[model samples]
Target: MKHVVFLSAISLLCTLLVSADTVTNPPHVVQFTIDPATTHQQIDNFSASDGWSMQFIGKWPQHKQEQMADWLFSTENNTKGQPKGIGLSLWRFNIGAGSSEQGDASQIGSVWTRSECFLSADGTYDWTKQAGQRHFMQLAKKRGVDQFLGFILSAPVHWTQNGLATNTGRGATFNLKAQHYHDFARFMADVVEGIERTEGIRFNYISPFNEPDGHWNWVGPKQEGTAATNAEIARTVRLTGQEFARRNIDTRILVTESFDYNCMYRTHPYVRADRGYQIQSFFTRDSSLTYIGDVPNVPRLMAAHSYWTNTPLTDLKKIRQEMGEVLRAHRVRFWQTEVCIMNNDTEIGGGGGFDRSMKTALYVARIMHHDLVYANASAWQWWRSVATGDYKDGLILATPDETLVDGQFTDSKLMWTIGNFSRFIRPGAMRIHVTGRNNDPESATNQEGLMVSAYRNTDNSIVVVVINYSTDEQKIRMNLHRPRITFQPYLTDDVKGNDLKPIRTVQSGSVTSIPPRSVITFVAAQ
Candidate 1:
């Protein structure tokens, strides 16, 4: 039997929307949809864009040459809808500080080539050995990525007086003495300028420190990391910016990638005990951390890592509201720069699945929704774009031998999920408003509940995404007040039939039922 309905109808009304009926409390399938023309619930103007980056492609085996490269650089279309590397907008180059130059325990073994921030003794800041990073940058350029963000873990050891890589000691001490600030800043500016001179491309932004709020033990030749206080971070940016300006280098700076929003706003040990300035006080002219002058005017982005803090959506919304008021007051942009699951179970499929898992995909979508809708972060980058571990957290996986992981490396489900947003909603796209029944939609559903994010395209098309977090089937109905044109809904769920493949698009404005724990993208093509 075949049924056909005309595209144009006088009044489109969908009824009897069957939803998950719970015995104790029939799960009231919350109705969520959009009215792009009149709805005023536009919370934040930015929905931070998401993407992947690499720092250690050279660690892969030669036989598998371009194995990861093929997926990220090749043009062949895989199982996913988009090309291998067409959906990303930003590429972060993890610049090394010459830790590879050290022998013994100083050298990071295995997959992640973790090295200290700076070079030691010999004072060698060579640009020749960073071939892997250089190669990726070229690929990113060839792929037509919009912006390139560069971040370093630490400064060189020769620049520090303590003979260590980090800033851990009594009373917020660092290897770089009070007088050596200029040298350290110059070294950083030099690296940026050198990369430009050698690679024919200039980095737009540089994040000098990574998670300055956390305490770590990189001692005894096992690892390389130093502690840095908020005050020191402000000072470093001031000096580095001056150095870069003196040399006429245009590379900008994004300040203090704090562990989380708490580190940025809350008064902690480094900000309260060790230093008398609050982290947010740096943006103001009255505070002591204001030594860099009006921080809002600087080309630096107020940044932090979304670790240990972005779990509950309600709290995340409250934090965003408070931060939004502050950012609006200061006239500065915020960014969720670095984040990854080091702890077990926090990240989906992160336990030991070398590739990205369904859990990881859902969590990522939820996190992105919160960041864009609540905090209005300008950009969001995963901690690491590529990893060859058994953990299912990376966007794509490749063995050192260049062989694709047993599964299809090019079109992983996680890749498709990320592509659903990154490919369709491009950079510079303003985030419009979309409302739902949940108090805090991002919070109510994560990997366990329902989640939704909506955006308006440059072509005037409205896109609404809904993710059901429950294991049971859900039926949802979207209501329109003064409806104009019809809406086309596309669903991507775990259903087996071709009608319910990854993306099942429909052209009706009726009540639709969604599968359990699935992601559906609805585009109202007017």
Candidate 2:
């Protein structure tokens, strides 16, 4: 009886072991591959702007400010040999128009949204007023940010028809007075020159308008903004370019930051007539509107915001495909200049909630992949680098109080997920072709819920970013085009916290397991 009972107990133990293995570690049937020889468009750079959020955050304690700077622009590794921050290649500086000084009279209700202009309403130029913004700019340069752009949402309050920083009570009409066009151009040019002289950082690009297609009429205390006809934009670009040349400024003019992708190619009935059909309106050689493509100091690229239209996977793919087709035919590149989780129709509902979870991170990753792969955007930029509100808009969030505590700021997974691309895929990296089965299909929506993109740096280093949106772990049988290449993986998941933790090196044809709901970047030498 003792022998029989011992034998039965051993059998039960074996069964329990098998059950545990089945529950915890399931088999992976997904296989993916990459072909380096197959190539795609070249990637320019990735960046985020220090907009309204930076105004106050820059005045925080020195240590807190430095920490935020290092996280965004530090290319060097930490003492533990991990990448310190995303190492952004470009930095955007918001060129305010004296709205903040107006206080409640600025018509912009939120003090955070109101920005101070170097040229005050009294026509006195104060170079020192925007000290906080300048400090961040200097920090970016110190940390090796290669590109700088200055963007304006509204002209000075004195120059507008309503004499207010917020829009005139008109829909889709140019809020900026037609008489002040040349003055505005001069103001912008002077700003470009002053920054270079004072801060030792030259503005490489100046975006004169932001979302000009949207109605900016004082719709219940929104940010300072204006709408302009494409003709007016072309006029501004011509004048701005002429002024830059006259002043010997090397900064190029970036035109027409369209509100959405569809706005670039099609006309919305509610939108201003001159604001829509942007690609053709500005770039086409034969259009009646003055062609700004050949204008001095104007780049051949067009920029648009990646908002609102990032949902219903099918629409995302179709609009991007159409936009890509138009751009390719015209030989003009696209830059997805700005994005944040705004519309509530996303996979994760968008809100002002300061969520630091992977859910928001994964949603952003999917949008980034779509922009790069489908739209063929040379550069991808986030809306705000830091935020003080409980909004999903910021990559990093801080407390609303003017003072900074020890742990007042929080870094979201969105920042690290973006880092997976920006930190590794440095500037001048060419996006190479990556074809595979299981999860690597080129569809807007994949059954496996995996999105993958590959890039090759100028030095021929390979970087592959894989996003697993599903709940099940995917076993990818990676078949590289080259032989004997070893890859190290850096993961941004709940377990690893966006650190580039290296697992065992795997050679070509080795099976790699991608954790569920994670973003993984694999780097390999040529």
Candidate 3:
């Protein structure tokens, strides 16, 4: 049967609705029909990057580092049954580009932003250089992180054309010297192989580029990055795949890592030639110079970031729709590999201040919903899992200072909001069909209130996440597979102190009221 809509005649009488703040007018009801039989992409994982922050934080006192890791990667539950941590399934380890080794002479102003490269200038490998990063990687494995990915923002300084990790004076040109392509590939493969041999952890996926499309100038005093054309990306990925094969490494190469979704679909007028339209450029048969679809160790997957593409709400969905169409046509899966609040997020007065408010959490939730549902992104990963700044970047925000060992570390509302999905929806879960939103199943969003998405685990359990963005309380009627199904709601709102606290249990066929300006996860087990 198709999805159906329902409204009770007594809905007007139930108008005395209680919101998160106070009693309000009777809230309107939205009937949500979740069909598990109809499903889409199988989620790979929900992940976050350690980036360069962990190179220092991981070196903190053993107890201090474990305290932070438990918050980000722990899956155990407390005595009250509330989750102990967000339980991230995947952890992205940064494969540095040697900026840190050069110190202040590297021209990268910030010492914290620079990453220590494993490949020394003498073409020798030092597996112990990134001690802080390796420390966290091992901790994640011990804590049950399911997958590990190694991502690089730039090639090592030794191989770059300008002998610098940042960018060359040549605008929009790839920083890597053409002669050192094979060397870079071999170095990355060596890092992967060395880590497996020494640390017993093999990267499941390796991304060769980060925003190769030149969406922004790679030349910055902030950190290391490189800009590459489609041809450059294709060549680098092919070489890396070959090197992986030569090393007998089982790691899959993640491609593109476009700066934004639009770069994956259309060539922006501002970008370099053959740099954008990555989905069609590298996958389609006719993209002569940049086609690496048949490369040896490459999977049929593409990844892109979610920066500068989210705004005005309506445009956000449309851009992702276009990106999804191309992905579907090519029969390639998509991954939203990276995201951080780098926009004019006017809702909370831009992305400048560190946000502990529910407003920022909902703002990010709406984007994640769009990516998973609209764009069919299999993996949703945040940029920095931990940070030492007052910016809206890190899920675990710390006091501002480069080498500050420990002052104050707090979990933002964004952390619990992510836990609503990352903790409940584990790897191998499938995104099932969710309909009955204003009778239009095409749009999975509610525009202003109650953006709901459903997923089904392999064990036949169901997870429904509802983001109530409206001020007024919203009511939802879930038409589930069986009658009298039990579900517990874990909420992340101001009233809940940004903690993912479990509320009272409710059964199917009963109307559940979700508090406004909050994210609620309804878990119905088998």
Candidate 4:
């Protein structure tokens, strides 16, 4: 089904008449006025990682590879000046540790999860390795991606205590040997320098550890992961900072990617005290542990993953509120650097099953709203941008083939749903306050039921994104502070492909209908 935009008055009248007849449930009247005076966080970027999937897909035929690149990174517009893809401002590059070349001995059974490393066991460097990841980096740069991030899941196998990319056991401990901290730091610095010199893409930020509080000691070939205590992470950062300074590298260090939002503020009884309450442990000046916030090149930002905390709407709101309060007190910013559907607790069941429907996409959008609105996150990013499993993880899915050539691929509504934000809300955009009421018949519903957020771009353009999770059409009455403004609505729904389709033009203080179970972005230039 093609999306019909009621551009003309006749078409609008006919669609309204049909909708009135078909929609028995009374339309929700949402009234919201943007308040630029009450501005919140400055949005840095909306990004995704080119991890396990990119290592292979980057090797795909030129045409297919170019298509994926354009879809993820293109900032170009049609002749009418509408965006083609979600203009992502940041690109995350995975810094591999040579597990892929080691085969089954690497412990990561899936070749896709294993990654190529530039450093060999003999302390030799091969800049030519990880050509696939480099290819994607170049593509992202060519498509106007300004920020590049290099995140690591594990250190080079040779430098690890267990001699494997993964942890030796399920214990929450650092896998990299203490004696080899300097070696690992130097390795990271060298890689950053080599890529910048050779490929002309300088990593603006480098995250050394991921999910440091999680247990990665599971057996078999699932994924390459490791755990580290907060103290260990601080030590690594301090060392890495020294290495970067010694080598005159300018990339900033990103700290402690927590496994969950709670870990950022609360210490789990099951985990070590030093491994949890990361924001306080790492950022606070008087903390018992070594504080790395004062370290050079360490930005005043705390990164955490938004997993398992997105449920029971109230709980989601409460967690983000608590996080925002704590971060604001410390004068530190928050970045939701990683998220995927890893649980089945809410209305949307999550599992390894691949879900290409709007259900998963809406679930993700709701979380994004909570993170941005409640948590005041500066940047939000998804996990793997591409996937090769039966999991509802990737924005784009590809065949399970290890070889990249001639493989089938598909894009999900989740990709376009993210585009509802990333396409318009570029970097430096400030989130403005928007308050509305979704008076559905169900009295138990909250703001999550019909989430709406607004942002002001650098060019003074306003982008309002609305996510309607209900079954009835929503009539939103946007009361802008500035009058006589025209809004162009771009919708992502079941009928339309993942690309954003421009719908009818709307005026300030006028009514616009958002189809049930759809995400719509209304753009108005100032």
Candidate 5:
């Protein structure tokens, strides 16, 4: 209630100083109009990555693991009206590259960052590998989670040029060798088929690379990642698509997971680097060296993370606006596949420290709004599902560091903040055109205050998420002309332990008081 109390004191102090003739300014009323006729991208899903953390937490005691999984995957709600979990529609399964098998020899610092491979050096496949990850996948399915995307961060270490999953230094080069591209592609297809046949979980989409842009140097000992030029990425994707076709794998291939948004539309950082201008490089008909859009089953889609877009908020708007324009011109669908707090050291202290306040939630929620409304992103996914550290990475914060054994796991405002969009907006839901009278949220000049976005689900229901970042509670009017009874509001903010908790329902066409520093998802189902 920092915002509420501070504003209250200011009002009181102003009252004492003002004369009797002092009249109060009217509340800033926001007019929202939803146009169903002009609809945008069909929201594919809201998802989080399992990374390497799940391998440890999935093996925890059944109840503990269930609790964690329930928070991430459960679609049901308690009798008290609190959602059991955020009900993420898609779960990103990380395809390991044998980093964990290398151990100390791998040169990757964090044991938690290492991942086990299903394919060994002898060219033999082990379906039993990544047991912990499989356990959570089963739990997610058991909890009614349907969609899954298998994402590979890096090629297997044995196939890499350096015989390591990642480089120790920065370089504008593909980690995997040219001759091994086909083998790596086959390996990816094999993993997709292997998981379905043995683990009983069929991957809906398979991503060949994670942040394969040249701008990002994946020499980090902190985690596992690789950088590849656009041409190499295209060649690998083509090979992977061919393998999928040959094996009759039903999963679609997702390619060129750019590290950041700049790389997607234009060349950034290195002018000579071919990683930039990914949409043109990979999807357009002009560039044959990197064009894979025509490949069988490869969708006309581009995926990029929302990293470094936090600072100067204007950059956030500009980058997305430009990206949206390019994406529209190319007619390519976009998905914000991965993002966590980064590059904002002075404002939010970067992603170093733990949750000191609800800043992380509010910040991320704004970016999510822009991604869906501005960039026309069909899918949005976080970097990690469960964070084992003090940083603002994971949705659920686990205790005892590694989360290896049974430990305490706490819900984060970031998780519920994403839920404000994810929980209500289901797959196949189309984002209807929304116009605000006082301000256009997509406008760069309008940064603060109530940032809003609305989506119409497949069942003809509407979900509107309102985010109030200002210190004062803002009043917003919904001009939805649909026949609705009451709109339910689930709030997540600095309200002391509020995790998508339901508040009093409101009548139709009411001006709602959105609390400051809070994210409220108003669901009005027909």
Candidate 6:
């Protein structure tokens, strides 16, 4: 009778375990701890790295434009001190090609009306047409942000062979001829001149080509350039640098905003990949144009976009290891300057929340981890500051109501996750090394879940972010390998969410537990 009772109890326990898995929500433990002494990199500053797709910049009613401008531009109205102080340390200006005037042909779809240039119609640079940009630039400058970079999607329509900004006949994109390279160079120089001559601001970096080898195209659509190879990029940089010198413009050229490191410099031909052409041969030491101009590295920055190629942290580490070997051999400064959420496992989720899901937050965290932990990128730039659509993977989401102050602006959890870095880590802060892997033991077994990224602040504060992508909660244990240290934690998760009013806090040291399907940021302050 005793044995039978024991058997009955065991059967009941097994039944309960299976039932638990079928429940609406499962159990999970997710937690993080920090060790300042084991830090390797110091965060200079948290950065926005995107452009003027600002929340209230152009969306406000015409009558309220100046008032919104005053609030955004004036230091007195910057109540949080973040937009001015330890806030966005870098700015990217998108020099549009007057696409809005092209109407439906602009190819960008119906999302945005193109921003007018400072100079309109006459083809001259008109600082006034860029009142919004000028106003924001001045505001950013006043907020103690001095670093600024500019990028142009396309040259003016008049300079293009097709007479339009889109690609030409034969369906193959157009590349400026060798002679026209100087013309393009002059165009960029004039833009710098116009900004300085008119807006009174100098751009320290000018990324002339954006995803140059990209095959995607649209009028207002995603564009495909004439597809310049790596050598062409090098030549353009040399020419652009010379023009800057001739015009006495100090703005440096950051060349080859290639889609990825492998695509930009690897030897393999991308056949089935998103970009099919081959440009990697040019970055090789054996290339004919090994010397960019008579001067080496006339373009100060070798910029690459961290897109598609690397998704997992481990894969990113491997890529970084390979890149380190390649870049070190060539002796170049690398910047993982551009990235967005457009590339991910689940492009769109059936669940409504997936649009701004923890997946977005985790993707940002994972990519940053790869850049900082493995690549050690000098600078990192996110694709856009704010976005109007779900397709582009914008950092900040704009509400649909056009009447709500340029419609409404919703701060994404991804924005807050970025804030986890940008808000505390200031620019010029060196990255410190952390002694832990972003992957959990189950990461390999599960294949698709849970991502983590960590950073050490300038003041020696340790910040660790844990992302739980699983349906249930996740428990994590991190051994600092330190004798003893006092620490604290700040977490943003489903239960806590990213509540700005007061972010939830946890005591450091010992086992840490995180809520299900959430992101937690743990800071161990010195």
Best by the lDDT measure: 3
Q: Residue 284: error of model 1 in Å?
A: 1.0
lDDT of 4: 0.78
How high is each candidate's TM-score?
0.78, 0.91, 0.93, 0.91, 0.91, 0.74
Assess each prediction's global lDDT (C-alpha) against the native: 0.55, 0.78, 0.80, 0.78, 0.77, 0.52
Per-residue lDDT of 362-468 in model 1, one digit per residue for the tens? 66666766766667676666655565566654666544444322322333455555555655555554454444445323333343566666665555556666676
Off by over 4 Å in 1: 1-29, 33-86, 105-111, 115-125, 162-172, 217-222, 268-279, 291-297, 312-318, 344-355, 401-412, 438-447, 478-502, 524-526
* CA shift of 362, model 6, Å: 2.2
**lDDT order of candidates, best first?**
3, 4, 2, 5, 1, 6
lDDT of 6 by residue, 1-526 (tens): 0011222222222210000111134444333222233333334333443353542354455544434323222223134322321255677777655555566564545425344444345656655564555655665675566777877766655566554444545243434544577877887888788787766678777887776665453112334234554556667777777888877777877766776677644543542232322233334445556345243325423677887656554566677767755654555556777776543544333213424545666556656656665665666667766566655456656554654346655555665555555555555554432222252222221213555555544554555555555666555554443333333444444333442212334432344555565555555554
Ten-residue region with minimum lDDT total, candidate 6: 14-23
Q: Candidate 5 regions off by >4 Å? A: 1-26, 214-222, 270-272, 401-403, 438-445, 479-484
Please state the error at residue 64 of candidate 1 in Å.
Answer: 5.9
Candidate 1 has an lDDT of: 0.55
Q: Which is the better candidate, 1 or 3, if ranked by TM-score?
A: 3
Best by TM-score: 3
Model 3 TM-score (2 dp): 0.93
- The predicted structure with the larger lDDT, 1 or 5, is 5
Backbone clashes, each candidate: 20, 2, 1, 1, 0, 39
